[model samples]
Target: MVRAAMESGELAQVAVDVTAEGTDKLFTYLVPRSLAGRLTPGQWVRVPFGGRRLVGLYVGPAERPPEGVALKEIAGLLPDIPPIPAPLVQLARWTADRYLSTFPAALRLLLPTEARRQEVRTLTITNYRLNVDDVEALVSELRRRAPRQAELLAYMARVGGEAERAQVLADLGESIAGPIRVALEKGWLTAGRVARRRDPFADEHVEPAPPPVLTPEQEQALASIRQELIAPPAFRQPVLVHGVTGSGKTELYLRAIALVREMGKNAICLVPEISLTPQMIQRFRARFGGDVAVLHSALSAGERFDEWQRIRRGEVSIVVGARSAVFAPFENVGLIIIDEEHEQSYKQEAPPPAYHAREVAAERARLEGALLVLGSATPALESFHLAQTGVYRLVSLGHRIDNRPLPPVTLVDMREELRAGNRSIFSRALVEALDQTLSAREQAILFLNRRGYNTFIMCRSCGGAIQCVHCAVALTYHLGDDHLACHYCGYTAPVPSVCPSCGSDKIRHLGAGTERVEQELQRLYPHVRVARMDVDTTRRKGAHAAILKRFADHEVDVLVGTQMITKGLDFPGVTLVGVVLADTSLNLPDFRAAERTFQLVTQVAGRAGRGDRPGRVIVQTYQPDHAALQAAAEHDYHRFFAEEIRFRQELDYPPFAHMIHLVISGEDEAAVAATAQNVHRVLAEGGFGGQILGPAPAPLAKLRGKYRYHLVLKGPDVRAMAAEVKACFAAARGKWRASRSVSLSVDVDPVSIL
Candidate 1:
């Protein structure tokens, strides 16, 4: 009976690893008897389908083979690879269904490039010892027909026995891809998996940083987290750590992480951006030493793979990184900490399964029985509301560490500055403060959300603004390059000496940016060294960390940058912070604009007065009396929350209701508009009670040559509304399937409508 069963083959249901929608459904395949018990649910396998081999995740046993067709046998099991944890697989499925994404896309979030592709064969040098005499003959013969292959052999021989095929191809150029293939066919190289060595910090020397003593407020917060940790498994409430900037929230996080680690459990710490990862990793490494593993988008694929391996092998007890780190493969996670939890960077804005790290962290903690801590100076409105509703516990760190006072902020109305005949971008007060700080040799930070030298150029004659030819936005004028570049599309052109419109020579570069601010600093204080940190200066790998490290070492007297500089920085010598334009983000076309503005102001202010010297801030804004700026200046989060929550409730935004932002886009504007109308009509016919607003043009109506139209659905019940929205979309998709010219995305709990 056993032999007959084995010969008949055991059937297994597998989710084929393909990222297309509607292709994520399960298919049954025969698992050879030899690998029957070895293959488990969540294990990766190669299966033959439609006359080709494809990787798939083994879901579970199938009840029976298909009614008509004979089942294809699984080709092979990926060797030495452990099954993905069942909980994560379940989580991925839930994320897919909730986010209107394919299961494979969700799985991609959990498994990065290396882990997913690790099972595939990689080309490596064959077993030819370089010290042997046969190498000369092989090289000579190769040089005759394939010079590139010969050169590759020579390079490899000089380097060592083996190297990654991709690395070699990348180094030599894609022209060598054919040579590599030839080498393998000629038996000069072997195709196999080779261990990749990736060390992102290989060149930099890292020192051990000693943990600071916890302040009383920090200790109190840690105690609350501990109580939750000791509660019944998976039932502990999430804790919202509402601390003021410089209030020792990091210390609380470290102490909590330490406690969890000491109990023989792992922890995951998530920051919001790649820019923050370096500083956060430095602190974590200092406390946890080699036991910490870092993950973020900035790391090379090999580095990320190595980090994942380190985690899987139990070589690290703590993982610190950006949003994706929440998916770290830790079997016994005891704690999860999300720093700067209010950051929009935590939300995945593209490529589906647009899951927020906070949401995932909360769910993961609940599933793993881990204590989840969300630390933020300005908690998200929804999160704070949850705390108020007793769904999450709230803890506060109201004061700065070591009795340091919050920096005093003065709002300088730029309108007032202009009236006083101070036509400079910097207000008189800010200029005076900068001069004083420079003279005293104390550091300062100038923050301007915009990056280039000028926000936009306008003609004095025609009142027309210089704009990107492709995009709807204005072109920013960069100083050094003397070019007008589109911030959205990367389109660049030489700055017109005369206005392109109306042929007027009176072109005015209007708006301040970090580049302009840095240039102005240089003009004002020629003797003081100035460093700029922005997208322009920090595009290269490790540039962010390098610039920050130099600034931390006091290499520059003043640092000018964008929102990247506002958070996760702890430089004591920095006594002054200047907001070049406080109203920059306040005027953005989004509901959370005020919330974002307040958070940026409060966070940047925290950077000041962190050290022994009392700090001061100069906020230059056109709207000084704006509630966001007012609340931030007074450092009154409660007041801001109350005011903002009222607006949110009245406007039917999150915390009071749910929103689904649907964007329809296509190369043809008419087609896009038509599809959007169809979707809207479908939703209305479905009897969805949600308020559906606009088949209107999106803010970026035309981007990358695609015309966009937007529709927003708001209601109290998101789950039911989501189902209705999904069904409506399905009907629209089916109707539009023949041409397939139009496409749409569904963003639930969208951070921005634009």
Candidate 2:
């Protein structure tokens, strides 16, 4: 029998573009009647076009070729690449165009990178239960076999068990697959297939992950989100979670997502997964169970493909993962909760598109009628703007669920501390707070945004600071390694006792960081068990979770950390928070600095007094008059938002208006500069009624060898702005392609164009 049918016909032409532009500039292709078994809709195929063989991603059989075009049958079917469903193809098309990504480009990129090959075994089970009739049939068949084989079957019947393929193979000693196939072919067995995934949560009960009992505040937040998700008629709405630090926003997500699943709809959660440990995944899994699909860059190609398939098939009821998980393939997406929505990690900085996960998820929810709950204690300015305008409903769990009063925040100016001649890492006020909290049997947290041992390696005589050789940045001092390292470029060097240029042994380190603060806290309070969390310490898979768990379990009396301490981690015992450096992010060159500073201080302040012990925060900063510090100390988000929005409106920034940044990058600095200039000129000439600033270098311009130049396109008309930028891109496309290293990115309604 000829199993493969023949759709024999003349070669047809199909245009396929695998680039980001997603152009399906149709090329000619033949339909192989002989390969009818393989020639299916959305099957991947290679083709000969324009003097070269290209991977002509199949879009389906074509009716005819254009005049003067030669056609060829799909050069050959990519047998391993799975067929893409027609509807998904449309969705991909829609996303590509909507996001201003090229259509065919988006489609090709959407396919699993390892789809062509590389399916390997981890481990899985095929469950089966034999009926009485089946057992009887098996016994009869065995009785007809040789005595030993018959005895084996009789033993199986008596045991009333299903044998693993490996066990059967070992028992048979040879050709186990054949016998299993024969038994199935002879209708003597039943089978159910299952696939193994990398679920580390299944193991490791030494530290169990379970949802904590929700406090009243947490319950209120969850109840609000639940109502939004279950609202009748299912109109799309954005719910801003304004819970302060340690307010159990994540716990609310667990409950809301669980409710979403219980309603027979899928829920997708986006976290900075690559930035988290296995223990975090375990927590999500422990609460969500096997129905939760964890997707991130850590998984193998095959694993990602399998997980993506599970999402596409709606086999997984919930997905907990990172930035790109916003694209999880669930048609009936009921809820999307983006935790830590304000963190810059939610933005894909390295990629050309530079998309923020929160924006993407919100946009998707708008399209899918899914309830979008942005769970952030430090809500981004964009979200705050939306909430203020009533575009998004603001729902806050204000007080810590423990019903503890808001932490008392006090700022200690470093200038005063320095003037007082006490150069210790801890300020007098902070030390006093820590002692008081510890005496009360409550935990204290000291936060230093910097992660290194010190601010920099400096020559005392010449006052020269060590800098990264490759980057325009100072090297950070690491006491543990006696090393000077660049945070941006990963450049490292041994600390020099004698300054190389000065030839002096007088080398001094200035400024304190997490490592220094942890050292000082332990030295000053020898009896207290202290744990430090920072980028350096939390690099391990379960480090953050382990530290958080230890702190929650009261294994650690004091937790000294960096900014991670601020992002929602609910603990029942923390009572004191010391901001070792409150002005770190506050002093950035960007206008958003005030907003970031305000969020950071308030967030860390909210972290303390979350337990029943009445948490308090002591902020040490040089600028006591800073508005952000003042507003934060007052726990005044509304005042902060108003002032920040006023600044934004004065500057004609987003929310008040619309802003889009057209970023151009290339190895050729001259070329990028030219492109940026041309784009600026185009926007200026387009008669746009708004700001057209900077055909100039961006913040941290030279990154990873790419000379980046940005053309800031701002206007009141968002649609006009987008169209103008699109025109600018279309004009620059030639220049972009001419340079292999050159790239372009468009960010619409960007939260922080930087």
Candidate 3:
């Protein structure tokens, strides 16, 4: 009866789940030899994944056969093609571990199947070369008699004339095949078959070239980086490049990345957002070859899949993309570069497990023995502290590569501007500066950090105009359209004629936004063209670049924008930078607000006169006395850092101690609050004792229909802190899961309180 369990000599069918848990292993089913020929690795196959019928990537022979359960056989292998290459499997493994995602998920990201697609074909006729002389004669005749046939002949001739047989005929279209058949009958070509290019733009590439030059400081920094790589590899060797704005940090990265590729390895370049990917990728593409893959939200799913596959196949030498690219399936990754690494966009504001890319990149590089370069004009305090304390190597790009001096900053206090009775937010001094700059044929950038202002609508009689129905936040009056909008959840309605609270008429839209600033500037300087750039203008994919190009080309006399104006904005003609609200992000209720305000004020003010023109800056803020505002206005990082670092140490915040943010959110406010309380209790129970700071409602407590609460756990031992967090999640799971309204979100090495 041991009838050999009969499975010994038979083929096996295996299905792998796509979740983070199952991808590393496969479930096997016995298969007779008859269907063995129909199966191949890398092909998509139907299987039960997490209680659902999911298409699992067909990986080679199961390491061990499933013992008792009756395994389902693969319905079919997609493409009925060649086996999947071994190299791609290795790439999948690397990416899966890096992202803490499942191996099957990684594979699915890389491989795309046309299983649910409409069948299509391109038909092309072909002929075997029966005689070389006869083929040449027929080609000559076809080149004149049939121009379409001549096109095909020319292609074959250049690649050593072999005609595509059946598949090519189907792909080239049946109509083209008929004329090709006439040429083939005359012995002009031979037939063969090939996979049609799914994307016409696929494999579009350029040859790699020498990297751009780096300044002396940059060269020295790279020399040290080379020294680090030359030594025995450390699992994680993080390097922070902190330089003034306009420093050659990016070029330094380009050089190091080139060195990596030259050594037969891969690299990943992570930008802050999707908007930056295109520009960053263009640089990589120009320097590297066509194999530079770009991944971002803007890409079509099919295109993203194709690019991911190309990366796994070792066809891509570099991956340039937004936050998600940190998990790219790049094999032998020697380097990871996070440009503008301190930008808040590195932290995901929504979604589960709200991880910060900069912190996660550190973990991934540590795991893979990769060199991590975090470059920022103004490094985050945590990162700067790491560099100062020797946790990371400090590489300074001391001067702008252009060798331009820092812009001269002039502070204009709002109280002083008000004393002049011209409460336009733009001081008379700022106006004179703007007028002079534009008259001299130079561009001006007006910076207003707030989008909708601290602005609000009011009824003179009732003193109350409007408020959101579901939120505790005020409704903003958008004068462009007669609408009242909630910036929190995007609840919008037409502006009411009367105050909802007391039925009072004659509502006044008070305060200023980019729109108001733009309108007033046009009134004062009508001949100067003004373009307002912010969320409202750049919602389109290519809109940001178009506006930036216009500004660079001197198409617009003045540029008015929100904080979006500061990101990678390069223009030598921008001689004056007007900071209409230097204290913008400072008033938020987070401890990091001071640091953020300093970063923005300094970085945005640095925008002026980046060229040889010797730029000037005019900063207007209510709190000119605030240290962040004063220090940024003077471009004195040392003064600001000293004061901020002292505050952090006193409070046992980051640099003094690590902080982990455990955010609890759900549709039910009470449930979310309860979950946070339960988390705090569990932390206390565990006795790991990190300063448990919150059970407070999040600054934006309700977002996108979810009520949020948070706990800022601070401690010196980050490892122990993380472990305690894990225990809390596990301990609270049972109690919370009993109710559908409860969920927990944990963010490690959090960048922002909000």
TM-scores for all predictions: 0.88, 0.82, 0.82
The deviation in Å at residue 382 for candidate 3 is: 1.2
Best by TM-score: 1
The TM-score ranking, best first, is 1, 3, 2
Quote the positional error of residue 696 for candidate 3 in Å: 2.8
lDDT of 1 by residue, 224-339 (tens): 99998888874688899999998888888888998998899999999878446477777777777788888988887767877876787788899988888888877899999999
Which candidate leads in lDDT?
1
Model 3 lDDT tens row, 372-451: 88888778888888888898898887677668888888888888778878877689889899879978989999988656
CA RMSD per model (angstroms): 7.1, 5.4, 5.5
Clash tally, candidates in order: 0, 10, 22
